[model samples]
Target chain A: MISIDKYAYNSRLRRRDPMQKLVFAMMTLSVCIWAEKIIISIAVIFIMGGMTVLKGGTPFPFFLRLLLVPMIFLLVGVFTIAVNICENQEMLLWAIPFAGKWIGFSDASLVKSLKLFLRALGAVSCLYFLSLNTPMVDLLAAFRRLGMPKVFVELMELVYRFIFSLMETADTIYNAQNCRLGYSSLCSSYRSLAIMASMLFIKSYKQSKALYTALEARGYEGEINVLEEAYESHWGWYIMAVAVNALLVLFVIALKSITGGLS
Target chain B: MNENILETKDLHYIYADGAVALKGISIGIKKGKCTAVLGANGAGKSTMFLNFNGIYRPSSGQVLFNGKPIDYSRKGLKELRRKIGMVFQDPDNQLFSASVFQDISFGVVNMKLPEKECRRRVDNAMEQIGITHLRDKPTHSLSFGQKKRVAIAGVLAMEPEVLVLDEPTAGLDPIGVSELMKMLRQIQTTLGITVVISTHDIDIVPLYCDYVFVMYHGMMVLEGTPKQVFTQKETIRDINLRLPRIGHLMEILKYKDDFDLDDSINTISEARIALKDWKARYLKR
Candidate 1:
């Protein structure tokens, strides 16, 4: 998460208009979910990966690592869908006898799980592409432009910024405790961790109070009305995004016609 | 009309927890001048600053801007804040936005300026603070000194009549301290903004501040130019503060070293000038 945030700030595509990025990511994601074809999913993955690693300048290995993060959950989830308990086992690829019946992988279930897993991964990659290029500030700004409620955007902005501060505070508290031998024993470790958590809560409360006063002093007047910074807007990026998504849709249609429906 | 831009007339604030942070703080901040409020820890410096722009309503007296008592209404507070911007000590607290550009634009945007005007001011503020290179950087990635500059820029973009910074150089390296103070001095004079800062960094007080107000126990212990304030060494020491390092050196040279030098020299340049004069006179004698 931290790496993603750092990359977002330094991303080569960071200057791109956030709304354009948001539109591109969300549109591709929805299409990827709707298409439900392994080929289309593969295409989405490659598109998002290429955008993030090549254009966005994120390290390819990092992108792959992030893509692998959800595979564990996807594998387990798809495993259940791929395996089934059945009385008739003619289509079973692998079977185990259990409870006077058979539990095994069937051809249809295996194909279904494969498509499901790939589709989910493709959707996640689309999100990664967006997050890897757009900083939280810009994303929140995009959301604000999208007519998300002011309070919600404000909360998100504050939460996003303070998460770093809270983590730093927690780290400092942990180090201070370590120097004092507060974590010498298991019992003491639990006590120290608990104390640190509570101290962080108190500290955060104080910080929020201070932030409120500071904001109020700056004519906050209850709304965090910050100017949206101008980004490099290009009609070419919009055209490319539409053309690419259109091709993905056409490919999905061709696959549906050729395979008589990938689902 | 009074020449003072900001005045707290016997202002008092007691927190809900029943702790009286200020008994009475009455001080007039001169316009277009750098005023340093000198105080030790928990000496009500922060509390008094909160009162400066009506962030904390005084329980007893009044806060005056340009000799007029502040209106605490919502609309009135908004106007007051536009004229009197306050920058806190902790950059982390002051910088609520992740992006430096967005954070700097907050004040200007809140003032309901045109979008183009807001952008211009934000860009100008970043340029003034020499953080235009950091315009795209996240707040978390900035170093302590950079964050401090961003916080000041956040207030300066508003183009306030008076900029109140609490401990503007609390946790800075020596060079960072000098650079930040110098930039603030430039901002004050160049933009014609009245700058008020509360700090324990006494050495810079003599070099930077035109007027000084010493706060002890929530009340003004002394108020004068830096030369006059630092010369009252015993009263400063009573308040758990001290003279500037150069002033202390000059004091030693006058009393302990039995050298004939001015008692009011608090900065290095003045000490140098005084020492050269002393040397010429002593050698001739």
Candidate 2:
């Protein structure tokens, strides 16, 4: 998660308007889910991955690794859908006899599971493209512009800002405990872990109070208002996004007409 | 003899848990002059600073800004904070935003200035702190010194009449300390903002401050120019504080070594000039 944040900050498209990236990612994600075709899903995955790596400057290996993170869950879910029980063995592509019924996967279920897996992957890739290229700060600014609830946005901003420091504090405590041999034994390890957790909680509480006082000193009148950063936004990016999504929709329509069904 | 811009009249603060932090503290922060509040840990320095911005209302007595008692009304505090910006010790606590540009602009934006003016101030603050290169960097990625600069820039953007910092030199490297103090002195001199800093770093007090106040056990033990305050060596050491290194070295030379050196010198340049004068007198002898 931290590495992804680092990449997002260093992304080549970081200077591009976050709203543009957000709209493109959401539009493509909707298209990928709506056009429930194996070919279209695969195409969406490639397009999103290509944009994130080639355009956003994330390494190809890292992108591939990130894509594999969901593969375990996807495979487990797809496995459940691939196996079925039926009364007629004739409907089964592969079957095993079980208590007078056949338990197996049919050709239809196999195709359905494969399509579902690709569709989910395609949807996830769209989100990855967005996150890999846009930092959380930029996203929050975009959220503010889009009329997101002020309370929700403020909470998110504060959480995002402190997460790194909280992690550092956790790391420091862990090291300090290790130095004191607090984790030398399993029994002590549990004790040390509990102590660290309580310490972190107390420290965070104090830190929150300090943050509030500091904010009040700066005239924070119940709002975490800040000037939004200016980006090199152009209508050309929005036009390109709409045109690409329209092309995908058109291709899906042409495929439906040609195959005459949910191809 | 500048008039006081901010003053506390016999101010007292007691925490909700029945702990007294400040006891009848009265001090005047001269306008357009740099002031230092020196104290050991838990000497009520931070408590006093919080009261300066009305973050902590005094239990007894009052805090005055521009010769008027600070109005505790919401609108009045909003107006007062605009003129008395504060930079906290822990940059992580003060910098609520991840982006340097946004964090610097937070105080300026809260002033409700025009958009263009806010942008200009933020840019100028970044430039003043030499953190323009860090403007795009996230707060978490910055070094501790860089984060300190960003925190200062955040407050400096408001263009406050009096900039109060609590422990500004703590946890900084030697070079970081000097550079930060230099920048602060420049801000105080060039912009004429009354700078007040609370720190136990004795070395910087003589170098950067025009006036000093020493606190002990929730009370003001001493207040004067650095030269006058450092002269009470026993009082300073009794309160768990010490003179600057040069001052200590000069004391050893004058008393223990029986050298004709001025033990009153606290800073390096002063010690050097004093030693040059002693050398000239010895040559005449």
Give the winner by TM-score: 2
Per-residue error for A248 in candidate 2, Å, reads 1.2
- Encode model 2's per-residue lDDT on A211-252: one tens digit a residue: 999998888889889999888799999998899889999999
Q: Write the per-residue lDDT of candidate 1 for residues A21-97, one digit (tens) a residue.
A: 99999999999999888888999999999999999999999999999999999999999999999997776889999
Worst 10 residues of 1 chain B by lDDT: B259-268
iRMS of each prediction: 0.8, 0.7
Name the weakest run of 10 consecutive residues (lDDT summed) in model 2 chain A: A254-263
* Model 2 alpha-carbon miss at residue A134, Å: 0.9
Model 1 ranges off by over 4 Å: A86-90, A96-103
> Which sections of candidate 2 miss by over 4 Å?
A86-90, A95-103, B283-285
What's the C-alpha lDDT at position B279 in model 2?
88
Score residue A87 of candidate 2 by CA lDDT: 95
Relative to the unseen true structure, what is the C-alpha lDDT of residue A14 in candidate 2, on a scale of 0 to 100? Answer: 96
